[model samples]
Target: MPRNTLIAGGVLVVLGVISYVASAFASVTALIPAFLGVVLVICGLIARKKPMLGVHVALVVALLGLVGTFMNVLKIGEVFAGTAERPLAVVVSAITFVLLLIYIALGVRSFVAARRWKKADAISQA
Candidate 1:
């Protein structure tokens, strides 16, 4: 596996932990990112050993991250409807949004790398 893939996975796991801990004080909806973080970590670990598996897993994670980020962007207004009442909510939302972007980028990179690795492996075997 590429070093970047491993690094990305590690970063995702750490971010997931952060999200999980941060969610405790935020609304129930915050758990969504927390859950995603765990999934990403598991997939990342698996990908480290099997590029073919990583390709599929990383792609899924990338797609989900994109969708999640898009949905959150659309709902940003609703999230910050009462910014004056709860400033922390805005901060947390922003943090989660940024993390999602980073996660998505890393996932895509890993996915591409995995695909290349798989192709190379096939060529070598033949």
Candidate 2:
């Protein structure tokens, strides 16, 4: 999961850089993904030392990322319909949303499995 976090962060950083460049550096807003990616990278580094703390923080960030981008994700239809005001931004947001969502899902799965394993261990000890 730590590795995955780092990878996701790397991807987001790239996405933001590309978006910013694509906009000819006119829109600082295009760097939103880069900011988020930085946070994730930090979390990933922390997780390397403390998996529980790091992953939980990452999950929270991912949840927030999803919420922040939900509206933009909805704008996908508009982009496809050629009605989106800023198609590139919308696409970037949508992509970010997907990445966060996937991370959250995988994190939740990992959490559940860990919990079950702990419970089983406790049962065996008892």
Best by TM-score: 2
Compose the digit string of candidate 2's lDDT tens values, residues 1-126.
Answer: 898898888899999999999989989999999999999999999999999899889889989999999999988999999999999999999999999989888898888999999999999999
For residues 1-126, what per-residue lDDT tens digits would candidate 1 score against the true structure?
Answer: 334445545555565556556657456554555555566667667776885686467556756665665644555565557534444444444555676566557656766887799999999999
lDDT: which candidate is best? Answer: 2
Displacement of the residue 88 alpha carbon in candidate 2, Å: 0.2
Task: Return the TM-score for each candidate structure.
Answer: 0.54, 0.96
- Candidate 1 wrong stretches, greater than 4 Å: 1-26, 75-94, 106-126
| Candidate 2 residue-pair clash tally | 0
Quality of model 2 by C-alpha lDDT: 0.93
Worst 10 residues of 1 by lDDT: 83-92
